[model samples]
Target chain A: MAQPDMTRIEAAGGRPEAIRLETLRFAWPGRTSFRLEVPEFRVGRGEKVFLLGESGTGKSTLLSLICGINAPDRGSVMVDGTALADLSAPARDRFRAERIGVIFQMFNLLPYASPLENILLPLSFAPDRRRRVTDPRAEALRLTGALGLQDDLVTGARAAELSIGQQQRVAAARALIGAPALIVADEPTSALDTARQGAFLDLLMTQAEAQGATLLMVSHDARLSGRFDRVLDLSEIAMTTRGAG
Target chain B: MLLPALAWQSLLSRRITVGLTIFAISLSVALFLGVEKVRTGAKASFADTISDTDLIVGARSGGVQLLLYSVFRVGNATNNLTWESYQDIAARPEVEWIVPISLGDSHRGFRVMGTSAEFFDRYKYRGGRGLEMAEGARFDDLFDAVVGADVAAELGYRTDQQIVVAHGLASFTEHDDKPFRVSGVLARTGTPVDRTVFVSLEAIEAIHVDWKNGARIPGQQVGADAVRQMELTPGAVTAAMIGTTSRLQIFGLQRWINDYPEEPLLAILPGVTLQELWDLIGVAETALVGVSAMVVATALLGMAAMIFSGLAERRREMAILRAVGARPWTILALLSLEALLMAALGVLLGMALLYGGLFAFRGWIDDSFGIYLRITAPSLRELWVMGLVLVAALVVSLAPAWRAYRMSLSDGMTVRV
Candidate 1:
């Protein structure tokens, strides 16, 4: 396979469309039976999209493709109008660190790190993201404050010490830090009660909107779709996707 | 830099395993480096046991055996040289000085050496370092005696104290009527010299006048003062240390003595003989090093096992790091860095233990074993071994680090846990 040319796909300062997929096809190797094909997909910059998917619907695979962690077998993933397939693996990693922030279901924060340290992790990897912030620690503090976590909670306490709800907010704060171009949340609110789930979604949506970030959240719950700008079920996007090939 | 911080924090979370691993590595390192120290020390101490003598002339035997008895005070000589042969060699113009030593007597397990006054003035050990008295002067009277540092210390004898010379090699049979006064005590030399009691050749002759063939003649009790006036010069000597006027004549003199017609003799160069003996013992030293190397390998393997076992529990942790934008290689580097830190710290800990041990036991080792070991810096070879240990630790860690890399790539940000 021909490798991507990272230097040619470098984008400058201005913002572009958040996500664009063209005839995307992907599958895990060794078990070639299962596959996913997205003929055409686009999410506008600053769009809040809810991707509804059941457990086996391949939502995580699609997210991995979008973030360039898994390269498409026969298509292109374009974020900010830059083709992820056109960048090398290392470049793709740098691009993801600079542009995409992801929140997993639970335990998203590093168990050994304090809440603030967890939130500041992305900046340590992406110098460009760090350059955009005047003071990273202050930015982390602001994000945690906006996420409704107290100062004392984020300062000295490790992520493992936080309660389930507190850890969810800390994950949100981490994903929302450095004002990345996109935020991908994979069942981030599943561990929360219904009332806290609504509150957590509200905080996440508000933080993403404030940074002008494109929020692509995947969840099985349909009740939270009313608050998103757009909603699409994973079954509509992934075709014949099996369990990790 | 940030990777190290993360690695350190990660290790701190599981400090117990890491601590145990480091401790195990340190003990192995200490054993490895400690054996090296003792090896070098043994060679150096052995080499320094005798110096500046052109030849050690003794009964015909192996060079090592000759050196063992003449220099180390170990074992007995096969035969003694007649007094006339010693005088014949001493009269040569090439012979600058000679110290004839006769051994067979003992005082409380310390060997007794009978020698002339020339011994104090000309004999040398450890590169021409002459004997220095720690207490009184050299023996002047017929019944006066000089003690080595260990002899004086072990027997608690000071100048002016009287001590009996045993009739034989062991200290059980004493010559009570012929007790001698301790006139001097030699300073510690960290050699066999420190375990011998020295007296004039006249004293050796006088104490044995009534004895024949290892037994006391029943009717021949000679008074101490009368025997002192009689001819007390020794008839034969065990060995003679010859210092020639020119280094060029040493081989000729050695050849001449070895072929002497009256008796069979062996003359050996101390340096050459010492080297031969060290080569014989070098095999054992190499084995010690090989065993310690295996111990170090085992300790590093323990560290690798610990890292491998942690991978299962850390799968989710790996996923979290990836979510925070750590590359797969970063995960690899983090794991390897932890192992490197442990090995480096182990080397430091091992060195500390080695030097600390040397310092603590310096006196006891010198006094008991007569092996003087100084706390010196690590030699280039020792440093290379330490470096090899770290490299081995890193190599051992590679398997686990590669596993982490694979886990991060396969599991992505959604570890099943």
Candidate 2:
């Protein structure tokens, strides 16, 4: 009964799902820690969802477990119908590189690398990062233009040299560079000033929408919930808490 | 993921740590190679000292000390043999020829030896070869002298220059009356003889004629005319070089010399005595090498400590690499590469330090102890040791690499802290 998203839509007369979680038992090993028993969760292809939860609500850990970082003690996580639990560590890393994009909350970008170099990292690791774009510079430029990163910053500016807001944009550009099927941003704008957070999140969601990327953004802010096509709160839907949400 | 520039940047960013590690490694390499270079050179020079001579005979002493004083001029003689005893031994049928030596004096720290003219004809060195003079000839005349190549070259001793005999083993010659003329300069033998001056027995006697108990007896001095009438021969000499006529008769020669009732004497084969000397001095070599190895090992520990200590601080950096799809092993590989690269740099710098140090202080070493250090680029031994040290360093430094691997693996989406 993987029916977490009850209002599933039909794309061209057939149902489509990008992410699925079933009976996922995620927990910290020691400290008699509580575990997250995910009964069910699903995201449709091309969907944008802002997953909101307070601090320590097990949202980040859910994202991690779904991304194949931590294996569920029971049940499974499925990315495009493939069980993440079935994949080996190296294979899991490869799958994430090719199909998934993650933007961390703070210092998400490699500090020493230029903006473009940081963006190009997915291709450096993921074998499938290359699509029709032959020249990485050209692809990077096109993506940077779409994201509205500064024109000068497009040419190899170190990520640490940028402002906090700029680092978020650079990470978004990197997440979108490979046109991955799914992009997850875990409180990506928490460190940015209030004035810049909206702009960065809007840019990230709009770009993922343009690339046909299913976007799942986790945030503690309740106000951002309505901006997404679907909104979910960990306290309302989360069956268990294993780690920081 | 392991681009050269990236590795270079990582190393550059942590320069203080890298530099300190490199410095520690280089110091160990320098000390290790320095000791090896000096020790090997010393052995080569000492072994190369007496090449052709068979035996060294002295007044009943250990073979090594006998060779030490007679050939290397390293110590004073315990006793001297009377001329009558020397002649008795030389007259033996087993003896081929004898090089009777008179010692115990120097001119400015260089040893002076009074020997018969047969020395020039019989003495051999460095592979049974005779001495090759860079400039003059042998000291055949009783009042003539021959200077060694280094002595002549260093002190600028010219042919036909006059020199007087010193009273003790070094400096302040006793006699100014009879100044011996330099007739020849011996070639570089790389032996202690390179610092010695060769003079005849007649010159030794002539210089001491007016002196009693190593002084010009107050008002009792004998004139040069009357000194010629007095016995010009020395009563005794330090030692003699024995060349047996038959190899089978070597034991006979040793027994005969040892059994001589008139004088207590010791017979030593120069070749065998040299082996004994090497055995006696081997302990120092082992101790020196042991200390140097410990120094090198400690430096490697420093490298591991420095890199592993930085692991916690670098967790974020490592996670960034992971997010970009860098495998955990790649992170480990980079760390190991850094360790190995730093060690290699240190080794090269250490070699340079050793060569420079040798070049700066060679003269002092040679002049102080008469040990001429051969300074050259790294030898096969040094290269092999360097390769082994680097390999060991890499293995020991893997602790940091292992830490890096674990960090990257555990840092899934974000840093733990």
Model number with the top DockQ: 1
Model 1, B1-417: lDDT tens per residue?
A: 788788888877878898888889999999898888877877788888888888988889999998888787889988997899999889988899888989888888888889998888776776778899999999999999999998888789899999998977764668898899999999988878889999998889999999899888998999888896798778999999999999999999999998999889889999999999999988998999899999999999999999999999899888877766778998899999999998998899998988998899878887677677868788899999999999999999999999999888977765665
Top candidate when judged by lDDT against the true structure: 1
Query: Over the stretch B249-286, how does candidate 2's per-residue lDDT look in tens digits?
Result: 99878888888888788888887888789989989999
Local accuracy by lDDT, each model: 0.86, 0.79
DockQ for each numbered candidate? 0.57, 0.43
Model 2, residue A120: C-alpha shift (Å): 3.0
Best by TM-score: 1
- Lowest summed lDDT over 10 consecutive residues: which window, candidate 2 chain B? B1-10
Q: Which ten residues in a row have the lowest lDDT in candidate 1 chain B?
A: B408-417
iRMSD (Å) of candidate 1?
1.1
Q: Model 2 compared with the native: what TM-score?
A: 0.81
Clashing pairs in 2: A36-A240, A57-A245, A58-A245, A59-A245, B60-B265, B60-B266, B166-B173
lDDT of 2 by residue, A1-245 (tens): 12222233342125547888877786765544767877888888889988888867778778878777667778878875567776778777777777788888888776666788778877766766765347878877787787777668867566778988777787888888868889988898889888888777778888898889999989999766666999888766577644443
What TM-score is obtained by chain A of candidate 2? 0.88
